[model samples]
Target: MTARALRRRAPEPTGSGRGWKEQTRRVSELCLLGIVATVLCLPVLTVGAVVATLSTVVAHWIDHDDLPPLRDMGAEFVRRLAPGAVASAAGGLATLVVVRQVQWLASGAVPGGSPVLVALLAAAAVLLTVVLLAVPRLAGGGTWRTAVTGGWHALLGRPAAGGAALGVTLVAGLLAVLLPGTVLLLPALLVLALHAVHRALVPGAP
Candidate 1:
């Protein structure tokens, strides 16, 4: 065969290929990561660490355009466990307080009634948004203290990005509540959404 004919017959390099197959592969990887992270979080206390590790993995994927080995996630989870526990405890306490307050307000035990309840709900939403934005910082190898602080600053610095991330999370929560089955994929989707929002908004973020 002629050189031109051989060249035309040669398959395109795998690395350079793009289309639905590549998109499907990426989605499948995220689903696997989500399932694995959810399983790791079954202990409850490890939820924070699992999220942080997943965030790191997703960030790595975003930077490199490929997922890392699954085994590496386990090592990252262990390394993050201590600080993640602290974050989890703090987050849990805060959630408990908010829930209690919401319950009390909803029962009409408070003076302002609906207005007060609305304000409280808004505050809780803002707090959750800040925490969502901070998950990526946890993977930056910082202490829980630093991650929380950085997350607050990041939200303040980029309110639009924070709002976008919060919207993504709320949508995910709604889907989980409505579909139930989607809970299996929620973890990875949340991490990916947060990272994508940050990468798209913040200048030079990976």
Candidate 2:
């Protein structure tokens, strides 16, 4: 299909009261097949394209009927993609470190012989946390360095809430797909369920 066809947002759904919910349902239904198809054929699509598409998906979930088409969103993502990407990569790295630390602490282990390891890890964590600041500015304007200071404050402001949300998302995303026997399809079902929840509250999200 053409890019336009591929990126078409779902029509406004039938409902009342919750404009955002209805919008979410509509977009979810609209993109369900395409998303499934893409996920199935993930090897065929470039990771960059998938990342761009997912960014559009995220934006769509946040904004409903008025959100721009996926094509335009993709183009927009291409224009200023570094900030969010860097933030995301850095965040992922941080998550890894946090997880590893938790594992270490849980193991009842003490400091290792590699004394420099702790220092290096601490420095990396500091840098990683700093990168989050640029994520907001990456949506439009802001220097990569400035994002560090701004992000530090935002991080402080929303620690608990962000932690809870991240915890839930990680759990749900992990359970989104399960494989038992030849195919149980439980994980995919879970993903759909999570998507349902996402659609309900997320604007224009699909």
Candidate 3:
């Protein structure tokens, strides 16, 4: 089959036997993917691409029942290495700036009600929302500029869906902190949530 055709093909519903076997196979596959994603994200710089690729894979699974091979996932990680590293660096820089600002505010260098503080917070929120949306867009393939722009538009166009994505992130974070053992399950859960959020908001998702 052509590459495009392969990309578009759906996964068969497990074996031709029992339904429970299919469920077991699906769960096992997701766990394997999550393990691969977790190990690949260890360097921090590849986090963005890892997430984007996982989001794309899960989105395809949810929307079309298509599951690409794990090798494809690794290939995507390598393919997106440059852009992903840039994105990771930008995110790290932004986090550092926010931390510095918070420290300044705590030290009383910046007044609590200062307009600058408000602006910073607003900018951070906007950036977070855009980043959340950008993953799915990047997974779909295109220039980072296009993904970011589309992400911003998606956030503006569907605030509810955007909020859902944020909620998913927050919930995953809380679970990780509250139940450290749950961290292993988080990768799959987060990907599923992202897929659901995008499927709900994107027209003709299925």
TM-scores, all candidates, are 0.88, 0.42, 0.80
Identify the leading candidate in terms of TM-score: 1
Best by lDDT: 1
- lDDT string, candidate 3, 109-176, tens digits: 87874667778887888788777776677666655678778778888888887788888888999989
Please give the distance, in angstroms, between residue 170's alpha carbon in candidate 1 and its true position after superposition. Answer: 1.5
lDDT tens readout by residue for model 1, 60-133: 78777788776887688899888778778888888899999988888878677998899999998888877777
lDDT score at residue 152, model 2, on the 0-100 scale: 57
Q: Output the TM-score of candidate 1.
A: 0.88
Tens digits of lDDT, candidate 2, 66-167: 445657755754554554456446556667876776567556574553454566566655554333222332222344456456545544664542333334
Q: lDDT per prediction? A: 0.81, 0.45, 0.76
Error of 3 at 27 (Å): 3.0
**Residue 147 in model 3: lDDT:** 73
Query: What ranges in model 1 sit over 4 Å off?
Result: 1-17
Q: Please give the lDDT score for candidate 2.
A: 0.45
Q: What is the lDDT of residue 16 in candidate 1?
A: 45
lDDT sort, best first: 1, 3, 2
Model 3: colliding residue pairs = none
A best-first ranking of the candidates according to their TM-score comes to 1, 3, 2
Which ranges in model 3 have alpha carbons more than 4 Å from their true place?
1-21, 63-66, 111-119, 203-206
